[model samples]
Target: MLFYNKNILIVGLGLMGASLGQALIKRRQSKDDFKVLGYARKQQTVDIALDNCIIDQGSSDLESMAKQADIIVLCVPMLSIESSLQAIKPFLKDQVILTDVGSVKDEVIRASKKVFGNMPNYFVPGHPIAGAEKSGVMAANSELYDCHQVILTPDIYTDKIALNTIESIWKFVGAHVVEMNVEHHDHVLAATSHLPHLLAFSLVNTLNHRSENREIFHYAAGGFRDFTRIAASETTMWHDIFKCNKDALLEVLNSFTADLDILKEAISSNDEQTIKSVLSEAKTAREYFTEVLQARSNK
Candidate 1:
């Protein structure tokens, strides 16, 4: 009902975009209430989405879709988001509400400003804090965002109506919407999401490069699999995310390095008390995090 009688165009029919199309289709109340259109660079993605009934229509031409769209959601990677914006800028109607699902917000905000000269009042910058290790339309699911957090990083110049519409759409898709500034979103996500992925990728690569990699994998258990699951995420997307949020990522990486050094020194010195204290602290933090997650889920 939030987007009643609206033509919503989704750019890039990958995991996030395809999932969004499915969500919107599930919420459709009448033939005229809402329509979902998807555009991807690959015609194969469009064909797959159409066959799955994820979108009412699909196309490889972005400009034509943008011309008819009342709302456009950019589901492309952080690095390509600017190009997508630029491509559709010439075709966007004055009332079109533009938004994105990129993980990094600051870079997106900058990109929009660069393309439009001034940030468009209708552009709402957002990040949906949900995904899987898989990529592409085949991996999309309507339940992917159910009860997940979606953060909106709106600037002062953003239109109130447009922001509300974007928030409503995410909430309708079963996301718990939250709002913050772009800088804070980047900094927090760097510590919580980006750093972990970086560590996972590094750990898996380091182990794979060793001569004993076969043995290492043979002896690996659930813990290794759990930690390395995210390392299987699409490399191109992660590469763009890391590049866009490098400053915030670097800050968190340095802090993590310092903590790692402390653990290394304790282990090398065979300091039983220090090691015990560190592990105890980590256990306490982990317990607290679990409790927090449980509480959020209950909400």
Candidate 2:
């Protein structure tokens, strides 16, 4: 109902944007259902989305699409957020609600502030904590966000109606919506998502350069393959995230390095007690995390 008769424009027709369009199309219930529009930098990407019915309509032209959207969701890379904002600013309707699905909210907030001279009341900074290792329009799945968590970071200037509109749309797509401040959102994602991706990329790179690299890969077990799976994610997108969120990521990285050093010392000194203590704590924490995830899925 929140999207009734609305023109929902997705400003970047990549995995996240295309997935959102697919989900919206799947949720259509009647003739009054909202329209889904998509925009990508390339006409080919737009054509692919249109051909696949991922979006009702799409184009490579941002200005034309921007003028028609009642709700605009920017799904571009972190580095392009400001540029995208600038491109669409002139055409945005006064009633349009703007949002984003970027991983780093602090950077998004800064970009929005810089573009608008302050964060607009109708602009909501959001992050959908869901994705696939694969990227691009072809990889988009209608259920990618099903039962997933979508975090919205709204500041003091955010309009309640605009925030509720974003929340309603995400919930309609099967995501569990939650709210957090920009700083807290960035910090939490740094420790959980960003750090893991960094470690995965680093581990894969390290193994790939080893003398026994081929043998290492050839003999990779289930755990090794599973842990490194995220290394196959889109490099450019992750690169932008790392650049935009360096401060928070570095904070978490420092903490992780300190722990890693302690573990290294324990292993080097052959301290059985210390080794067991660290491993035990990690195992227990992992179990608790698993429990929490399972519980949320059950909900």
Candidate 3:
């Protein structure tokens, strides 16, 4: 048990943090190895988490909790992570292993270096590829991370022991842990996660501005619903993400735009072959993803 008899401090009682607390509490029911405590900027969020029994205790005093924690997981948005790290820096124990669930990692690591004067070996940056359009503690669930991918971006200076401990905790919560460098992680996520979300939000807004908006939504099919589901995600969180990871996001966006132009030209010029080729390629790519998901499930 990596967290055996440890006090795990989860900062931010939002969807990721609350769900992690629930998973830790569920694990404790059998092993009694770790205790989960929570901290949130809002007292109401802390109270809600306590009332839901997601956390063993809750507090707004981050420094106090940081001093007592064996592991600290920052589950706040990408932009808030820097401030969160700075808040706990004064009290952060040398032995404490720190990690985060922020989607963008390069900025988090950069912030860590700025605050600490160097990247601390105990700080293992991570991103969990699991979430929903829903936000807040009420949307949290213990099974949110089950079978999900959690990527850890650790450099050569990172402590191996701390890396192993963080990996073990994620695995305990039924996540498939993978390791990669910060740049690669950011680039991959920009293409796979960020671009899709941006497109979803943009598409929804475009449709909403049309005169037939109500009719469009009323007659929307499952495909439209599935594609735009992420558009309902918290605007503030995504706004921060876009700002923090603009470079990688823009690179992916340009590629996607080029693809869109190709399709637009194909249709405009009445080129049947080009249109069919694009559709066939997209279908193949999607089917490949389905096959990969099924294979992982079978394991």
Worst 10 residues of 2 by lDDT: 24-33
- How close is every model to the real structure, measured as TM-score? 0.98, 0.98, 0.97
Candidate 3 per-residue lDDT, tens place, 1-299, comes to: 77788889999999999999988788665546788889998889889998887898889888777888999999998888889988998897778999999988998988898898888999999999999879999998999899999999999999999999999999988999999999999999999989999999988989999999878998999978977798989888899889888999999999999989999999999999999999999999999999999998887
Report lDDT (Cα) of residue 253, candidate 2: 99
lDDT of 1: 0.92
lDDT by residue (tens digit), candidate 2, 32-118: 689999999999999999988788988899998999999999999998999999999999998999999999998887898799898
lDDT of 1 at 150: 98
| lDDT of every predicted structure (CA atoms) | 0.92, 0.92, 0.90
| Residue 3's lDDT in candidate 1 | 81
Q: Give the Cα error of residue 99 in candidate 3, in Å.
A: 0.3
Query: Which parts of model 2 are misplaced by more than 4 Å?
Result: none
In what order do the candidates fall by lDDT, top score first?
2, 1, 3
Instruction: Provide the lowest-lDDT 10-residue window in model 3.
Output: 24-33
Per-candidate RMSD vs. true structure?
1.0, 0.9, 1.1
